[model samples]
Target: MTVALMWEARAVAGKGEELLTWATHQPLDPPPLRRETFRAPEDRVLVITWWEGTYDTEGLPELPEPGEDLVRRAVHRWRFETVADGV
Candidate 1:
């Protein structure tokens, strides 16, 4: 099975670039199958990582949160399992 983890955060006013830089530089000890980063209006940043296990798997790698001052609110995270594929 394939598991994908999503992490999203909203940066403080006028610090979108700094927040994006911070998110891209974070390292996963064992690394995931794939990872991607994105940014949006209102200074929001999103990171998604794909792994080869279930959401409850032990010791799965995940990105840690950045400093409090970097963001305006708590980060949001979610886990999902792939259920279908397109031709």
Candidate 2:
């Protein structure tokens, strides 16, 4: 099945441009880039990306995560295979 990987993070202080730069410049291969973003009511931004490929976070490089607080960066990737017409 098709999958959609969503990630959201608040603008740190005045890091809006930095945030977008970091996300857009991520170095990941085998998964073609498909990214979109939006501004929330509270000014927080929501960035959703559709990665077309198998789901394997374990194999990907590790990202920075806060000790107590939630990840500044997160991923919600889902993988689904296609079905045959005769199946």
Cα lDDT, model 1, residue 24: 97
lDDT of 1 by residue, 16-75 (tens): 999999999999978899999999999999999999987686777888888999999899
Residue pairs with colliding backbones in model 1 are: none
Clashing pairs for predicted structure model 2, backbone only: 1-80, 1-81
Worst window of 10 by summed lDDT in candidate 2: 62-71
Please give the CA lDDT of all the candidate structures.
Answer: 0.92, 0.47
lDDT of 2 by residue, 1-87 (tens): 334455556555556666555555565465545556665543255555554444543343322322223224443333433343254
The candidate that wins on lDDT is 1
Relative to the unseen true structure, what is the C-alpha lDDT of residue 37 in candidate 1, on a scale of 0 to 100?
Answer: 100
C-alpha RMSD in Å of predicted model 2 compared with the true structure: 6.0
- Deviation in Å, model 2, residue 47 alpha carbon: 2.7
Name the 10 consecutive residues with the lowest summed lDDT in model 1: 54-63
RMSD of each predicted structure: 1.0, 6.0
Error of 2 at 32 (Å): 3.1
